[model samples]
Target: MSDTETLNKLRGVISKLARELNTTATSEGLTPTQASVLGLIVFRGPLGLTELAQLEGLNPTMLSRVIGKLTELGLIQRDPNPADLRAIQVESTEAGRELSDRIKHHRTEAIAACLDQLPETTAQTIINALPALEALAQALRSTHN
Candidate 1:
């Protein structure tokens, strides 16, 4: 395939994978964005609203809405930031952590099952490309920042 064709194919595959993951997240009563927010909180520890907004590439208002929904669902809590009493800190609740873990487990299982169907050499090639893939992601993120 030409470079353009190859890029298009890669994009299509990635988009499909994202759709599948979104479907899985939706089944667990979370949108992709909500799941992502919970996962970030779980992994990064508590963060102030502004900080989380920056990290999530979201505006304060939108992030606030998302946080509100998550809070109502009991997946996250907004607490007063100790260092900055005026600012609020967001953290994943125990329920949020459990749901995040379950979502991750489902995603891993789904991917592993898909990879299992692929020929060993093909799967190994994809594994070997992980670093390049990560670099590509970082480069894209840098451009946005």
Candidate 2:
């Protein structure tokens, strides 16, 4: 097959994978954006509004609305930033932590199921490619700045 044909097939696979992840998360009661924010917290720990906005590649106002909704639902909490004085840091509450874990477990199970269908060699290839995938993601993020 031509390179273009190969790329097109990969694109379809990526879209399907993304949608599967999204559906799995949605089944756990979080929109994609909310899930993304929760991921930032779980991965990077607490951050100020501006920092979270940058981390999520979103506008502060949009992040604020998401944070507000999460906070209203008792999933997250905001506290005064001691260092910044004027800024507030957002962190997951116990409920948020539990919810995040549940979502992660759901995603893990879904992915494990998909991997189970793959040949062992293909699954190993994916495991080996993870570091490169992470590097590519970092490079892509840097390019935006």
List the RMSD of every prediction in angstroms: 2.0, 2.5
**Candidate 2 Cα outliers beyond 4 Å, as residue runs:** 1-12
Q: Give the TM-score (vs. native) of candidate 1.
A: 0.90
Q: Which candidate comes out best when scored by TM-score?
A: 1
lDDT of 1 by residue, 43-127 (tens): 9999898878888888878888889999999999989999999989999999999999999999999889988999999999999
Cα deviation of 34 in candidate 1 (Å)? Answer: 0.7
Candidate 1 clash pair list: none
lDDT of 2 by residue, 33-145 (tens): 99889877866778888888887888878898899888998888899988887889989888888888888888899889989999999999999999977886787788987
Q: Pick the candidate with the highest lDDT.
A: 1
